[model samples]
Target chain A: MKARVFVTLKNGVLDPQGKAIANALHGLGFAGVGDVRQGKVIDIELAERDEARARATLKEMCEKLLANTVIEKYEIELQA
Target chain B: MKSAVIVFPASNCDRDAATALKQLTGQTPHMVWHRDSELPQVDLVVLPGGFSYGDYLRCGAMASQSAIMRAIKAHADRGGAVLGICNGFQVLTEAHLLPGALMRNANLQFVCRPVALEVNETQSAFTRKYEHGQRVVFPVAHGDGNYFADDETLNRLEGEGRVALRYAPGQNPNGSARDIAGILNQKRNVLGLMPHPERVVDPLLGGTDGIKLFQGLLETLS
Candidate 1:
């Protein structure tokens, strides 16, 4: 089984990298891009055969280490 | 006073912290590794600045979960004094020992320079030597020094006088809320700040304002 986690800064949190990327896009003449927020995706391979169990484990990982929760939000996707 | 400086793998400021502690207290601090679960008897514990775990996953995230953090938490729980500088400050917040998180500078630049700081709370064990509202200069070097917290938390911190230091008026280097440069925990035993006071302890280093911080700690802890 495999799991993927998408971590993103919360809506109100300032994202400097995202801002920089947005500016760069503007410089390249890509107009009409109102806002850009950058995030990361982490892929993990699990030995657990149960999709439910893998998702549960991934959630724990997100809460404990993957996502800070204070400034970040995470989504978990499990594949069998 | 006895002190210990926790050394995470990528910690670069441990030596400077140890030097500052030894120079002020006349005793070399114990250099405890991150893997150590036990701490020697000490009056203070310092988490020095550095790119711990290469600042991977987030600054201080991995290091906060190290074996030694449990011991550090235990010490802080017992009203033991703990000081965290720069990345150390990030670790404290990540560990939930302090409030708020440090974000990248608003300008997305690595800021490193001497900035004036105003002492907001002199009653804490760490700032007793300075008078409230005193302005001191300390060098801050960090890429992620912007401090962020919700409005309620910020209000609570201000109302409770937990804010220990703030950048002098119009000198906010990293867009920290209320220009906060340092803060104390609810117990006032733990302090986390972004400036590198340890690097400014010697007169030859161009400033000694930072020495008063260590001296204050020694006076209260001893």
Candidate 2:
């Protein structure tokens, strides 16, 4: 089994990279782009066969290292 | 005073820190590796600046989980002095030894220059040699020096005078909130800052504005 984690800056947190990307897009003529926020995706291969157990462990990873809860949030997705 | 400098792989400023300590305190600091778990008894431990773990995941993220951090945390818990400069500052925040996170520079550019900073609170072990409101120029070299925290936490830090240093007005190099250049932990034994004070301890290096910082620590901790 595999799991993917998407980590993004929190709503109130400033995302300078995201803003820079947005500016570059606008300079390149993408006017429709709204406020852009950047994040990262991490994929992990888990040996656990139980979905519940995998989810629990992944959550722990997010809290411990995958994301900095003070400025970022994370979402987990499990795949077959 | 006995001092030790934690040297994580890729820590480029470890030697600079060690030199500063030796020059000021007249004692050679122990160069502790990141893999080591035990710290020889020392009055102060320094987390020097560098791209520890290649700044993977985030600046200082990987190094924060190093085995040596366990002992560093224990030392801080017992009120031992800890000075974290630049990347070390990021590691301290990542380890939850201090509040706030050092995000990418607000300009999305690596900022490396001397910026004027004022000693906001001279009561901590790190800033006691400087007078309150004293202005000094320290070089800051980092990509992720923009400090961020919730309004409540910022307010609490300000209310408690935990902000040890603040960038001189309009001299914010990385857009740190409230122009915070450095902060002290609640116990005031741990200090995390983005500027490189150790890099300027000698007049031949550049300027000697940073010597008082080490001298102050030696005075208080010895």
Alpha-carbon lDDT, every model: 0.94, 0.95
Q: What are the per-residue Cα lDDT tens digits for candidate 2 across B113-150?
A: 88899999998879999999999999999999999999
Tens-digit lDDT track for model 1 on A1-80?
88889999999898889989999999999989878999999999999998888888889999999999989999998877
Candidate 2 has an lDDT of 0.95
Model 2, B120: alpha-carbon shift in Å? 0.2
Model 2, span A1-80: residue lDDT tens: 99999999999888888988999999999879999999999999999999999999999999999999999999999999
lDDT (Cα, tens digit) per residue for candidate 1, span B1-222: 899999999999999999999999999999999999999999999999999999999999999999999999999999999999999999999999999999889988999999999999987989999999999999999999999999999999999999999999999999998899999999999999999889888999989999999999999899
Candidate of highest lDDT: 2
The docking category that best describes candidate 1 is high
**Which residue runs does candidate 1 get wrong by more than 4 Å?**
none
